[model samples]
Target: MVDFIVGKYNYWIYIVLMMIGFYAMIGKKNLIKKIIGMNIFQTAIILFYVSIGCKKGATLPILGHAHGHAGQAIQTSAYINPLPHVLMLTAIVVMVATLGVALAIGIMIYLKYNTLEEDEILKAVK
Candidate 1:
């Protein structure tokens, strides 16, 4: 069963990392730890995108028609999906934005209660 599952999808490593990051984010109570978890999650997403863009047998996506060097038009048959790359790029940008905002909020929360613990902050708030 393990071999069959591994053979079906070679990207299990990325999936595992993503799950770890998700688990950290959910399991941590400290705001800083949560942010680190978020960063890990984002990195896992980037890795997943890069893995998806990998093809078993394909040339780089660079066209070279200007220098009279005509080998064969880059094979389009084995080209990996570019959509994942593009989406990952957008997701990375969004992750940065979210991190920035989260940091700002964390700092504000710290200032208000002088604590990094979520439970402490809630207790102080109440």
Candidate 2:
């Protein structure tokens, strides 16, 4: 049990963070708070995905010099997979864009209603 917990502690941490973000998004009343929660959740997911791509005792994917000898083979296990890193980069860009758009909308709503609270905004709208 100790070995399992120790080996996978990062996963547990990510899960806890994800839960907090999820709760904030669902349980919070204020629009800004919900946006913050969504950002937290996105960060947790990005971290989780990046962590998954990491390998023990692995080097970067950059190729070393080609050996003159024919028997020398590049070991796949020596290099870490780069796909997850690239995907996470794309995800981060998307997340930032989305957050910017959402915040802009929030600001517009606030300007019109003068309240960031969802309930209050609804009341104002009605």
Candidate 3:
């Protein structure tokens, strides 16, 4: 039972992290906390993607044919899928950009209201 659980545990961890991030975002009253939650949420997603991309005994997909002349050789074996890694890289960039924007907006809000509390900002806006 332990082995079985261990074999397929990444999904469970991903779900738990996702839920924690969601709860933090919803339950926190501070802008910084919400941002942290967002970061956690993004990290959880990245983790899920990376976990899914992993192959049990595959090597990085680096084509040796690029540097030398090789007759077309058909080889069928395990090779790491580069798509997920590329997608994750793009996702990381987008997440960082999003976080930067969120932080900038939060800073603007703080400057306007002199507080980082969501409730206080809402009250002040009213």
Candidate 4:
């Protein structure tokens, strides 16, 4: 149990970060705070994916001279699996675009309502 927990500390840390972000998104009344929380949540997920994609002895999946041997059989296991990293890169781009759009909308809301709080906006709306 101890070994398992100790070995997977990165997962535990990210989980805590994810939960904190989740709470901030759900519990905060300010639109800016919620946006920040969402960004944090997305960042945590990206970090988690990146962390899991790494291997201790793995090199990049480049096509040249793996393991100091040119013109030799390339071992697949020697290279890192880059799918998760690639997917996370795309996710990061999407996350940034989403954040920009969300913030723009939030700014529009504040402009119209003169406030950024969810409760205040709702009260103003109705």
TM-score of each: 0.79, 0.88, 0.86, 0.90
lDDT of 1 by residue, 1-126 (tens): 988787646468777877888987999899999999889888888987877787767655454464665755555655666777888889999999999999999999998899999889889889
What residue runs in model 1 are displaced by over 4 Å at the alpha carbon?
A: 1-10, 64-72, 78-80
Candidate 2 on 27-81: residue-level lDDT in tens? 9999989999999999999989988988999988676654553478778788888
lDDT of 4: 0.91
Model 2 ranges off by over 4 Å: 64-72
Residue 60, model 2: Cα distance from true site in angstroms = 2.6
Deviation (Å) of 105 in candidate 4: 0.5
Which candidate has the top score in TM-score? 4
- Model with the higher lDDT, candidate 1 or 4: 4
- Pull out the clashing pairs in model 2: none
Residue pair clashes in candidate 3: none
Over the stretch 9-69, how does candidate 4's per-residue lDDT look in tens digits? Answer: 8899899989889998999999999999999999899989988888879888676644578
lDDT of 3 by residue, 4-114 (tens): 789879988998999898888999999999999988988899989988888878777676665563666634355677788889999999989999999999999999999
Q: What is the C-alpha lDDT of each candidate?
A: 0.82, 0.90, 0.87, 0.91
Number of backbone collisions per candidate, in order? 0, 0, 0, 0
Candidate 1 vs. truth: CA RMSD? Answer: 2.6
Residue 95 of model 2, lDDT score: 93
Give the higher-TM-score candidate: 1 or 3.
3
